[model samples]
Target: MASTHYTPAQLALHWLSAAFIIWALVMGFSVMLLDVTPTFKATIAGVNVSLSILFIPVFAVRTWLRLRHLRDHGHRPGERLAGVIHNVIYAVTALVLVTGVLMMDRPIQVFGWVTLPQPITDPVWDHRFHTLHAGCNGLLGMLVALHVLAVVKHEVVGKPVLRRMWVAR
Candidate 1:
């Protein structure tokens, strides 16, 4: 029998990470559609920095929980297909986030007050990372869509896969 249970920490991390990624994508998309004024760019930069900081703690906890799961359970599922897909999902997600941080070119300010050093300052570096981040985000989005299609197919046509990422659905 397949294991359908995801520990509470795992479920929480799964949804939280998904929500953060979606929020970041929406924010970036929205900001880019506007005219680029200094103040406007600064505002979006601040938001990016704040969200990146939030990513740090959540990713740390998520990684730790994953390590703990591996250490505690020597018996991992032998389902090679799902395991590979999961690894690909995380790799693309992490690449997008790390590159996004590296693409920052200006100081981040909080509501016209305090400022933080730009996460990345070099224009060439920023340009490279920006391209990579966008590319990875696009690739990751497609992969996520495929993953979701697979999950829906499983739920409707076969055994459910989303239960492993959800709260006992």
Candidate 2:
């Protein structure tokens, strides 16, 4: 069976993570592009938080799985570069996720269902964090683009970059 490339579980995680990240980026850009009153801002924050709850757990699990896969860097050295790139991408993602949380200016209310506590109290500091969070998010996007490019480079030019995740052997 050609060594079956990625395990089913690993493939599942890969696709799911891609979908979630794309959705999150879309939602985030939408929220930032449109402005509204504080009430609406709170509503948007609620949506972001709900999605975030899901995003965080998946991210945590993926991180755990990723840590166990250092076996990729066995020989040709591309593995080492890929590992470094992967680490950089994850670090930026963690920054965006965490700073995005700290920058919230309102509480989360699930359409009159539940209210979640606002983590940050001070408005000025929170606003500062908001700027920082947005900046980090931008950096994260760039990293993702670079990651994609690197994958293409490996697959088309150098070696099978994505074969590890997408194929298996």
Candidate 3:
């Protein structure tokens, strides 16, 4: 019988990305909600920014792998909707990363190890990018929720969707 599971590398990337994204999202929200010092807030923001930057390549590889899977295996039942969701997730994620970089006023020091040059210098443009970043994050949040709900629904209904993604063999 043909294998119905993703490769271990794919599963590793999927879980790693999920963990990083969740951490970034939680830190992003915590910075907004907590009454923290500017230094602390900057620290949180720095970590979030670094994670976002790091995620770019990971997302790219994941997308390629997903597309390859689709081409090789063809779409399973109800997978068209999943494909749409995955594409939207990628688009919004890329938008968020771009806007995030543009929203900064100075070079981003990733964990103080490396620095990324600021893309936008004007305050107006930075503000605009910030708005777009926040909006895209909100949309990402909803999409993630839907994705999780669908997974849960499948699991509840005895589908092995999650297993296909989570298990290697």
Candidate 4:
């Protein structure tokens, strides 16, 4: 039998991670496009780093739960494509986060609460990782658009698939 809904914990993590990813993307573009001071840009970078770091464990847990659910309930019709898209999203997200961390030239401070030391300090590698981070984010943006469109398509066709990920009533 296929499960009709995700557990509340899964839904919570899904929505929370989605929100954070959106925010980070927006902030990332803002920093790149706006003529902000170095101080302000650093602040935004800190927030992005902090949020990306936080998302690591969230994604791990969500993946584990999703695998468990799939194991227990089996796949539903049309789920193969959905699963591939989801796995791509996971991979792109991890790539973005990993490259973001690797691109950092200094310690990352989490909203002034905690500080993390840089894992690498080589300028050449940092530049390379920065490029990779930007490229991955571009890919992530497309994947996210596809994801949202798929949900909308499902809804328009009367599937109402969003309810499975939405908070339970």
Candidate 5:
């Protein structure tokens, strides 16, 4: 019989990833599209850059856990499409992270503790990477919306999908 609940580590990673991704998406779009003050925009950019840098390792660990779990447990029945969609989400997330690093026009400062020089120096190439990063990030946002909708649908149909992922008392 298949276990109904995700492991504790899995639950933690999932919630952490969800919160960060949603926050990033909202802040990113707001900074790009809103008429915010330059100072405010810069502050948000600095914080987001630092967070993204720190998140890289967390994402790597999450990916490793996901792959290991899949190998150990295999896929459940009728989950092939969901698996494919999830893989696409992961791939787009990887692109977003890589392009974020590649597009840096300024030094990456992680919460003022560490500073790494920009990865791409050429203006033209850096702009291109930025464009790609924005596109990939948008795709990730859409995929996340779909994932949430699927969970809601499952809940409505009495599957208790959210319960499976919720922290146990």
Candidate 6:
């Protein structure tokens, strides 16, 4: 039989990913929309770049675990749609990360400790990547909203979906 609750590792990773993604989205858009000084904007961008680079490994591990789980346990009845939505979310997240990295026009400096040369040097290509990254982020935001709503809907219908995902005391 399939396990009713997610593993503790899965629970931890889920919350971690949620926190990082939400923070990035909020800070990124705020930097664009608000009248922040150029210096302040650059600071936020630098920090975000570092954080996102750090997050890539975490997301990779999470994706691996998810795939392993699906392979071992498969989906519960009537959960195929949920599985598809989740796959789409993962694909978009990968795109967002890739585009974010590719859009960089300067050397990637991580917390002042490490620096990697920019992957894309052409200004035009960088701008294209930036546009794609923004679009992907928007789609990711919508998907996250839908995910939250689905959880709320399940709860309203007396399903303990959150409880299953929640870390045990």
* Model 3 TM-score on a 0 to 1 scale: 0.89
Residue pairs in clash, model 5: none
lDDT tens digits, residue span 96-129, model 3: 8788888998888777788988887899999999
Better-scoring candidate (lDDT), 1 or 3: 3
Listed per model in order, the count of residue pairs whose N, CA or C atoms clash below 3 Å is: 0, 4, 0, 0, 0, 0
Model 2 C-alpha lDDT per residue in residues 8-103, reported as the tens digit of each score: 666777788777666767667777787767777666666767777567778888877666544542333335575687788788778878877777
Candidate 2 or 5, higher TM-score? 5
Model 1, span 1-169: residue lDDT tens: 4344668888899898878777776676667767678788767767766776668679778867765765666334666686678778878877877887678777655454566677877799899998998889788878877887888888998776665676756
RMSD of every candidate to native, in Å, equals 3.4, 4.1, 2.1, 1.6, 1.3, 1.2
Give per-residue CA lDDT, model 4, range 1-169, as digits (tens): 5777778998998998899888888888899989999999988887788888878888889879878987898677668788888888988988998898899888877777888898888999989999999999989988988998999999999988887777855
Residue 10's lDDT in candidate 4? 86
Residue pairs with colliding backbones in model 2 are 5-167, 5-168, 5-169, 6-168
For candidate 6, the per-residue lDDT at 98 reads: 96
* TM-score of each prediction: 0.77, 0.76, 0.89, 0.91, 0.95, 0.95
122: Cα error in model 2, Å: 0.8
- Residue 79 deviation, candidate 3, in Å? 2.1
Winner on lDDT (4 vs 6)? 6
lDDT of each: 0.74, 0.71, 0.82, 0.86, 0.88, 0.92
- Model 5, position 73, has a per-residue lDDT of 77
Better of 3 and 4 by lDDT: 4
lDDT for residue 90 in candidate 2, whole number 0-100: 81
If ranked by lDDT, best first, what sequence of candidates would result?
6, 5, 4, 3, 1, 2
* Model 6 lowest lDDT segment of ten: 1-10
